[model samples]
Target: MKKTIAGVDIPDGVMAQAATDLIRGTESELMFHHALRAFLFAALTGYRENLTFDAQLLYVGAMFHNVGLNAKYERSPYRFEVDGANAARDFLRRHGVAEREIEEVWVGIALHTTPGIPEHLSALVALISAGVQMDVRGARYDEFTAHQRDEIVQAYPRESGFKKKLIEAYAHGMEHRPETTFGTVNADVLDRWDPNYRRLNFCGLVLGSDWPN
Candidate 1:
């Protein structure tokens, strides 16, 4: 049986199992709902772009993209993005998915929050990043009809304090490992929560270059 959401037919066999369910269950209501909306937006973006992609792969990428914010992946030495990326890779491997396909999902989640590149990359990866941006910051909000936005939100309500909760989750996921957030949006969490957190300086690196320009 195929699951339908906002007129998108989720790919038939990609995500139907006890393990996927168990992994998804780890996120909070907010993250879970956000995941659904992410998929909708990703699918919508793909449709608009007229790009052919593996819907199931996009679904799985968006679905597990935030698992790093959960307790299981939060403690890993790797950055939260990599943690989620690794989790996705491990899950697909366990399910016997093709190695090449698994790598696509891995790259998608790993670069989901990475600035700039994901958008120009594979459709599966691009969709996840675009979806997340539209959901979080309303990037290209005008591209989506009001009805479309309302319907997706109705299905996955963005509860009150969602923004605050999101920040808290990010902080919780990376607080003890502040070094990992240095170059990603995850840095904001540390900046807000840990007063001592300092961002790296680009000019300082240029000035200190071993070979003077």
Candidate 2:
């Protein structure tokens, strides 16, 4: 079924349908809801900010941004972000989308987990980062008026079990590939859940270096 959020419509179509179907079929219910919410939240961000972007591209990014955590790519050696990005890129390529647009969506999904960078790349990338953050951490949450947020969430209800389920999915996806999680937000998951995980600290570099000063 098609849906709308903050006035932007997400129709079931070439760019969105296949990826949506795959995730819905393979991932958990919480994950599927989260993907839909990511698109709505990102679209809401773009709508509220009057940001110009390819809605189809943004939807593609949102729909497949977490493919890494799905059973299809969960065990990939790359970060789940990269896995998701590759999935989006391939999907776009198969549909004869231009190389440039495919790259845009790819980078957006791959870098969505890296903070402070995507917002500066371009509109689609920025929106993808913002949308993922909006879904996960409520970044820039104040922009959405209460009514808007209610409408989006109501359209795709975030079940009470989402937080824990999403977290577990991330951890399980990257548990065997912990190296991929380093330097991205996924690191935090490993830091908390995977017992054998170790977090990197740059302070060691500063302390170990001999300062000429």
Candidate 3:
């Protein structure tokens, strides 16, 4: 039976179910629900915008977008976004998904945290970011109806203090690889949570370069 919410049918294909099970088993309850909600929100956004997308691909992207935050990747030198993207790539490959489709999911996950560019990409890529931003940053909140909002939350309640806790999760994921946060939004997480965290300034690097201006 396919679960439908907000006029969207949740993908339940074998690959989709396998991907869901993987995340549900590995992620914390809060994060697992967050991933599901992100998928619903993204699907609804695609419908509203009249964009065509592969719901399965979007589901995979949503489910794995934050997986890198798990303690397993704490020592990785890559940005959490890239780690999550690479994880998605490996999973899709194991399932025998084609390289082209896998790359779409990879870009969707990798760029979800980027501030301004995902929306300009393919519908699949754009909706992943849309769903994540809608859930976390409340981006485009007014675009969805109250009914849509109410049902998604009722289906997957946001844990208390989601905003603060999400920030803490981000901080925890990146604090061990502070160098990776440079030039990305994860730096904001460290700024808020990691005491003694010093942000790298791009201009400072340019000016300090051996090539004198």
Q: What do the candidate models score in CA lDDT, each in turn?
A: 0.82, 0.83, 0.92
Pairs that clash in candidate 3: none
**Residue 148 lDDT, candidate 3, scale 0-100:** 94
- Residue 135 in model 2: lDDT: 88
The residue pairs that clash in candidate 1, if any, are none
Cα lDDT, model 1, residue 103: 94
Best by TM-score: 3
Higher-lDDT candidate of 2 and 3: 3
Candidate 2 lDDT, 1-213, residue by residue in tens = 666666769857865677778778877777778888888888888877889998888888888888877766655778888888887888899989999989999999999989999989989999998988998988988877888888878888899977887888888888888877767888899888978788766786577779954
> Per-residue error at 133 for model 1, in Å?
1.3
lDDT by residue (108-155, candidate 3, tens digit) is: 999998988998999999999999999998999999999999989988
How good is model 1 by TM-score?
0.90
Give candidate 1 regions above 4 Å deviation.
11-14, 17-20, 205-213
The positional error of residue 165 in candidate 1, measured at the CA in angstroms, is 0.9
What is candidate 3's local distance difference test score? Answer: 0.92
For all candidates, the clash counts are 0, 0, 0
TM-score of 2: 0.90
